[model samples]
Target: MPVTSVEKDLNTLSMTIVADFASPLQRLWDAYADPRQISKFWGPVEWPATFVRHDMATGGRSHYYMTGPNGERSDGYWEFTAVNAPHSFEVNDGFANEDGTPNDMMPSMKMKFEFEETANGSRMTNTATFGSVEQLQQLIEMGMEEGTRSAMSQIDAVLEDLATFAAGKGTELQILSDTQVRITRVIRGTAPQVWDAHNEPELMKRWLLGPDGWTMPVCEVAQEPGEQYRQEWENTKTKERFGFEGELLESAAPYRSVTTEKMIGMEGPSTQNELTFTPVDGGTLLTLVITYPDVATRDMVLATGMTDGMETSYLRLENEVLASAE
Candidate 1:
């Protein structure tokens, strides 16, 4: 875990937070630059953030929102003032509506982030300036200090995920055929560990759930060819449940597996999934290819935002499952 310290200056109407992470400066910089990575740690653990739009260049704008445990959402936007890759950036940050319109009633602030290489890892300092002492007090009263500190503490976890995805691995989302889509990621773990994470019910329960407030109530896996597997997840608060069950078409321990998937509530054709795991320098390169019956069906699944869900799930797999293996 990282150490985050916040200092508030009422006279200057400013707050500065400094944190040291046991990760390389470039890794930390990349995490902030990538919107998907930003979503992993931009908020506290309980309230996760989802980035709707991200443009990391000078004069560009970014819009995102944080979703609370009870499904409440808080929207915000950032207008980039300057961007120095792997070093620093400046932004005007403030609250926004669902349509990304700036909220006039909210106080806007200027934020600057600086990253420096340290002996063990990297050091980052964030300085935020408010218009007046009253405005600063208003934000502090809204739990900004505690929220920011809690968010900063998750940087190490995000850094681990970024490192896994950056290890000469490419995330390719391609339409292999009219009815097929392929997604791949080079994960950081041995072949055996990766296999366990996918095949073991206990390990699968940890990171298989896509988002924060969801839990896998039922997870059953039979790791042999012709065996059946099923997984079910529910929103703990809403009690809404959804899942899929499939039978293995091919199974090879620590290497490859193929299955036929029929989604529970989704009406359509079943999908064929093939997973290949290969040993890389320090981990395994896992490639997943899913095939549908027709282009329209594939497009329909894509419209359901499966890519983002899978990406987030894989990130959790790296941070929680693979990191634990080490």
Candidate 2:
């Protein structure tokens, strides 16, 4: 998680930043390939960005805008010059008008992104070449150095989300049965690592919470069939508590498990959960199926924004547990 360097070369009129991430190279490449993922961290934390249109191929055009804190907005565009998946891509990056047209008044830079696999993880080098020293200095004065650094710092979170939603790991909700719904994700780790994260209470406390400022004060797991488990969390500020207790119905370490779950404070019949972990392309494909009493119960849970909340929690699991697992 160390940023190796951010350097500028006046002679070459280029700016470069090098950073390493504890993620696979494909996940890093995907951050640029998917526009929805790109929008998550494409701008500085203070000035969030929104992508109007994105086409990630050679000669494709990407139009986006970043809104400043004062309601001001800056539009930008990227014309892809070359694309080599999971390796490198080149683009002409510059300012754009509100109508998604290039603005002639501003200077454009030829930007290239290169990804390389390292012993620790993946290394990314971003190089932006200007036409002249003056142009480089102009952009430097415009806060490009600091702004780019701020934006790049958010890539770790994006990578985590990408790993979970990688190819074939559909984020789309799927109805499995009249009383069941399923969602699958590809986490960046082996089967054992994923199993540990689910069974180990200490690890569960790190990512299972729905949102920030929530702490899991009680996480007890009995990893044997017919054993009972309970997890409880509370909002630090409001002291609002929520949790679920369950009995392990079946246990097959690092592969599959089935459990019966009941929310402590919620009014509903206990649900059945089946989790299967399969190894795929050096990662773990986790399939989660939850069966409620009826379709109305399943739809009711979905309407509470549970999908988004669960997705967020899974992303945190990828970042905090899977990515760093040995």
Top model number, TM-score: 1
> Stretches of candidate 1 above 4 Å error?
172-326
My TM-score estimates for the predictions, one after another, are: 0.55, 0.52
RMSD of 2: 15.7
Q: Mind sharing the TM-score for model 2?
A: 0.52
Model 1, 78-108: lDDT tens digits are 9989978668989999999976778889988
Q: For model 1, how big is the CA root-mean-square deviation? A: 15.9
Candidate 2 wrongly placed segments (more than 4 Å): 162-326
Cα lDDT, model 1, residue 67: 89
lDDT of 2 by residue, 163-209 (tens): 45665453455664478676666677877898899998889999988
Q: Cα lDDT of all candidates, in order?
A: 0.80, 0.80
Q: Candidate 1 local accuracy as lDDT?
A: 0.80
